[model samples]
Target: MSKKILLSWLFMAILCLPVFAQIQEPVKFKTEWKSVSADEVEIVFTGKMEKGWHVYSTDLPEGGPISATFNTDKLEGAEVVGKLKPAGKEIDKMDPIFGMQVRFFEGTATFVQKIKLKGGKYEVSGYLQYGACNDENCLPPTNVEFSFKGEAAGKQTAEEVVATTEDLALADTASVDLVPLRIGEDTAAGEAADYWKPVIKELSSFGENVNNESHSWIYIFFAGFVGGLLALFTPCVWPIIPMTVSFFLKRTKDKRKGIRDAWTYGASIVVIYVTLGLAITLIFGASALNDLSTSAVFNILFFLMLVVFAASFFGAFEITLPSKWSNAVDSKAEQTTGLLSIFLMAFTLSLVSFSCTGPIIGFLLVEVSTSESIVAPAIGMLGFAIALALPFTLFALFPSWLKSMPKSGGWMNVIKVTLGFLELAFALKFLSVADLAYGWRLLDRETFLALWIVIFALLGMYLLGKIKFPHDDDDTKVSVPRFFMALASLAFAVYMVPGLWGAPLKAVSAFAPPMQTQDFNLYKNEVHAKFNDFDAGMEYARQQGKPVMIDFTGYGCVNCRKMELAVWTDPTVSKLLNEDYVLITLYVDEKTKLPEPVKVMENGTERTLRTVGDKWSYLQRSKFGANAQPFYVLLDNEGMPLNKSYSYDEDIQKYVEFLQTGLKNYKR
Candidate 1:
């Protein structure tokens, strides 16, 4: 009897061991539902594995690892269609323990299944059976349950239906019919339209291009600092530094008080500039400023403003504030005491130096406003103020250092004239943006390049004393610094001359108009895509029994053009793209409008889709979870992704391998 009782306890312990092991499994499962159409839904299952553990794929061979399997409970009006599809990177290796090749997924994996629905809403209950293993141990097969419910179709008003239909018709003309698959009236029309809305906030989070707000702030700060340094060399600002510091030192017999007052004056300058930056940000708001940065009207305005600034620098006219303002501030400085006197003095200097510093400040603000950060302008102003104030504070601290500083003279006027030429060249960049957006054809690639070449050539001649401006001294001999500036200007001009006939000119690609705008061609590569539309490219791929390569780009995208010239121009990459795949180039900046306007909801916000660019931009965001340009994805004829997507990488071999890998996967 004792032996039998011991055996019974052992048996019970053996049975409970499996249950305890199942509870310790490291993989977790989750399910989500997406409406594909009225009759179909996409069920996405994600498996998250703990560190150092992995789960086997469904296609693993027999006697290898335990493959993941999905089984559904009885459904009221739904049936599974096709097989489960894997949607993440997979690893294949020869396992010594199993003595066979095996495929598994580590970290996270997404598997999708299509389900056909009859009607109404339904809860799809399912259980996923899978096994996980680490380097040291393997767990037995375990089951986890999940359920998700979604509506088969959203209710759409008659106007919405009509608008969607007309939009589809317009899209069809562009060979990009975006109609949701449904019989008769699309029951998923509202759902489809909602999916296409601009996901601006989400794109920065989950999309491939993460927000670099901090990085942008750093760049803006440095740019402002450089601009401030340039402003200090101007005739108006440079001469005042010595005079202002001498006034403070000579007026105060106490050296400590003189230094303290000078530092206060510098601090006051910083405060004033930073306050202006804050005012601009508060008035416009960050989001509005971001939009304004991309607006055609604002670009044109910036262009005109820069041109005016250039003219001022060229001695066309003085850009000055009212004299009364500076005089009042000057009087206040004389009447006040302590820090207040220094603050008033700093304000007076700012007003007096406006003719020189105003253009620099305006250009800096215009550049900083383009950054997508709320505090970017403030940070930029702080940098500029710090640079502008450093010299005055240091000279006051060590009065003898002022003797080492270069005396203001005719060279200051030369600096201003050189800056004038640079301003004129940069102003055209803003004009190019407006011209491209509005399709004005006023400044094409060749025309823009010609203007730049002429401007820089003339600048070179002026620097070498061959050309003279109104404010230039009568000296004909070029200084050492002027000679170097002339050489740089001439070299830059010579470099840009090739760009007129289709040279990439990558150094200035960001500023120059796109190469497509050039009529004549000499450096053209032979990798042109046969189709620039999605549906047409896919259809061609299907007919030819090849995979599809989708290039999500933009007309204004500098990186896209760079990749085309730098990487895609390679013979290996070009052949693979042109022969092995049906290439589709979707320009997300195409501004042509649709036949009818369609409104869509995104994260509770309503957005109206009106242009061709909007439709392609929406497609890229919705389908691939990305919004940045120069995005590349490989797809089979069925629109299923073949492999991992790519972004702005300029490696030729990597791109060739990406294409080859997609082709291999498609053939398999």
Candidate 2:
């Protein structure tokens, strides 16, 4: 029950944790050599061992440590021309831990090598890599550096031959040199290479595409919280609280009854959201949810769905249940038929608060779909319920506290206006989808920056009473939140102003367009780029020596935004994108107009391509049989799929595995 006791138990549990009786040692590489015959120097890679564990046999099909690899230093007089043969025997059978026979080892395994010597001495260097695993966990294979001396025949007596060790050679375990996205480059002028080049390199190698399947619950819970927060801020919801509490007091004139109803209302909110979350989880199983997250079609649909919600946020219109449904819910609430009325009251609360909570709910639901955890949506709803229900319970406990919150006034309108700006800011994510779908590239890097600048600038002006909406209440002075908001908006707008001219805007780069597309000045300094265009990126994917990593991304994809924040920023994974693979970022919801003759069918719906997004959407839905951004398709140099396509999520490990599998598959 106590923290200390719990921690002690946890530590003890870890200490006695059932293990596969594996050995683990700080990966160390040592060197040794011997004469196999007259003219050959044989290198013996005796990877030192740590007690209690064994390195896995490299010949693992189902599970085991990775194979130990040996490479030779570019030696002048010596060359390695034979395959590495380890001194071990293969044993495959059903094991207790592994349902299938898994490759494993005990103590140390030696990889024997024979190198023919020509005339002189030379140093050969490379790495020996193999994963070591206990019954509980597997440490990823890492290369330990080892080297050996090759001498001309008769140069040294057999007695002179001695074993030696060397410092660990850096193994390419998730090794990616992330050059930040930049302009111009030359390895020759090392001192002043285009700074942006390094930056681009970094951006290109944005690390581990998350799998998110496991953390579905976290996303769902977060969505619920966002919904509850939005519900709290709504004009209608905020005003009703005091009125409802007053009604409860006046109706019964009993403080206890008033408290009871307030608690009931809050509990009702929690029940409603939790039920909704549970219902969704029940309807969609984990595997289905995984499909939706990775499915390109679902992604496009989600992107479009967000656009619809954004439109609603911008006063386009309201999407609601039937009028009769609301009336029925209201009628039930008014009936006062026992505690049932409270439940009805909660239902009515949801209906009435729909205008405010609708977007948030939509956003939350879309997010939960990716989690693939049955409870994720429910968890999200729980978070939302807590945020919404907290105020009611807290306020009822201290009625006097109601007086402290500013009386509902023009400030409420200020809140709405501020939310409107956020709505617009989020709207661009949808447009970005269309931008990427079609090849127009209309909403390029700098353009995205400008729109953000304008949106925030307008928000700043509105805060200063320079702008008003149709529903705005005329107010001469800004309130506490409004003033702070205005300052934030103004400063943020100012921060982006330079981006239009070509600033890297690292502060906001994750959310902004790729640096290659920005037109800017400092921080991301560049000598106007001569980089190839989007078409070239695709061609490069096909022509390059390495494979292509096709990123089906959209501007308005919320999960795509999340993926950037959660996954791509990981340093270990980002380097792979920047270096080994050619990245083709395709936007599926581009809004730019097509030149001509762009017609297509998507989901059996016939359409003409007026915008770039249309074509891209069509391509994804039709050609690729996918409709998701954050969809990754690994392809060989010839543009054929090396492995099955994978979708995005919060699990970086699975994503890394997918990438690793693709590379391994191709190498085989």
Candidate 3:
């Protein structure tokens, strides 16, 4: 009797083991669309979403998913009537805190794009790019080019919309513009457009769609601004700002001529910049744009390069080329005194401006590289060149205005010193890049913030006449510009001080501090909800039967702050969050540490786990192939990787779309 009982108990125990392993299931995500009319297209997306798996919003990471965007482009004789809105059917979701009352289905989600075509037949085609995540991990984002030929609709019905999606045909939006590419002398600035044509075409051929929504347009705008700022300090440009005015004044003996020359200089700069942008597009095309901007080596190199520029600004070194070259260019300009002379003048300006402009140029290369658009870097460079070339161009065009300009003595040095502070602060970012890539974590958020505090504070003091430098001529009285600069630096310091106490500091949250380091924050829109442990959060996600969102963040990550403020605050964004996820913020810079003594092998060294950030960073590098902040992931309740992970973006709408897709995958 005892032996029989034992055998029966053993069988029951074995039965329970399989039940425990039932915590997760593998899920696949697939999307399809149907056109209801030339003006209205319905998206019928299906998620082979597995049990206990979930994806996230389009707003999840800035670039993780393509925003479920609908557009009506160039309707020859047509006008876009309206925007695409979601009134769709979805998979069923089971959750307590999030996604509890949501109606979702594991197999399909339907979205409608309503467009009122105005009186003409046009080819209507667009792309559908979404970031999908399953139970364990999120997948790298993929997009589809969807297209259709529909006539202006006279009428429509719900049933017709549903039927069209089920039987959609291949889209005709597969016209790819491939610029041919050629490898030439390394010294060449870039390859010709013909060189990249084949590459762009080939990538476009991979799938019939071209959707690269990961990069935010704001970044491009910012690139323009930074480029302008860098150009302002270049010697080639700055000295000429006044000299060019004098030259035109001497030649025409009219203030107006100088102004015209200055204007010409500015115009030439713009032309140069725009051409550079075109060249970049011609060389790399669209495919390389995405990788160019977010590289660690690029950032580090840029930072070091900036340091060199800063040193030059401090008069540590003279960045001039051989006198022979300058003389040669000058001689050529004298020989050809028309546009070529202007061009020669510009050439001289460029050579002279190298010291001041080099750092900015380097920054352009690094930041522009992050863009997925072939023209991004060039466009960015163009913006800078224009800014640098502006003063001379405008002053030459109106030479009389040059008299209003401040004398360039002590003020110039002061400007250089102020910029040096910025240089130092920015250098840490590059070092942080290296640290993150190599698993150093030496310049993590708190440390970074601390460094900025010091650099800026010193700048403020220096501006206030409390400090002196090697080039000082004894007069330390503060000018208004210098005062303002100092004040701005101090204000920045004040802004970051709150972060050390655990504030999110949303404005620059992406780049300032990691969320993990934040003592108090509310990423979740739900009121009064407190989450203090990772396991608890995961359990809640499991019980709610939704996916867990693990946010690996840190203090001093400028991009992170920008993302949180710019994206997470949107209304469509917040509502979706409350409905779909259990948010877990892991601050890679948090000072918290493992409770007991723990030693782990990292980068070939067995080191004792030091702080909270150490553990999280170790996990991030070991698992996710990253060391940057604002990293996001969607996992099943039981901790399986879902789809490919996404990085970050600055757009709120796109982020919202990312989450919606993640939810669809989770339900499946």
What is the per-residue lDDT of model 3 for residues 397-432, given as tens digits with 9 covering 90 to 100?
A: 555677887665666667666666677666666666
TM-score each candidate. Answer: 0.57, 0.49, 0.50
- Pairs with steric clashes in candidate 1: none
Candidates 2 and 3: which is better by lDDT? 2
* Clash number by candidate, in order: 0, 67, 107
Q: lDDT tens digits, residues 1-668, model 2?
A: 99999999999999965332111233344667776655667777665555434555545543223455565435556667587776765333333112123454455567766676666666665555555543222333344545555566565665426667553422221222222221222212332222112121222233332233444455556657876777687775788777776666666777898789888888888999889878876877754665564443454566676666655654557667677887998887787765788778778878877777777777777656655457777788899888988887788888898889667776665665576677667656545444543435666778888889999998899898898776677757767777888999999999988777765555665456454444444442221111222334544554466776666655534455445555555554566666667766656545454555343332233234444444444333332343435566676654355565655555667666666777776677
Span of ten consecutive residues with least summed lDDT in model 2: 195-204
lDDT (Cα atoms) of all candidates against the true structure:
0.71, 0.59, 0.53
Error of 3 at 88 (Å): 37
Model 2 CA RMSD to the hidden true structure, in angstroms: 21.4
Residue 361 error, candidate 3, Å: 1.9
| Model 3 misplaced regions, further than 4 Å | 1-222, 233-236, 252-262, 277-293, 516-668
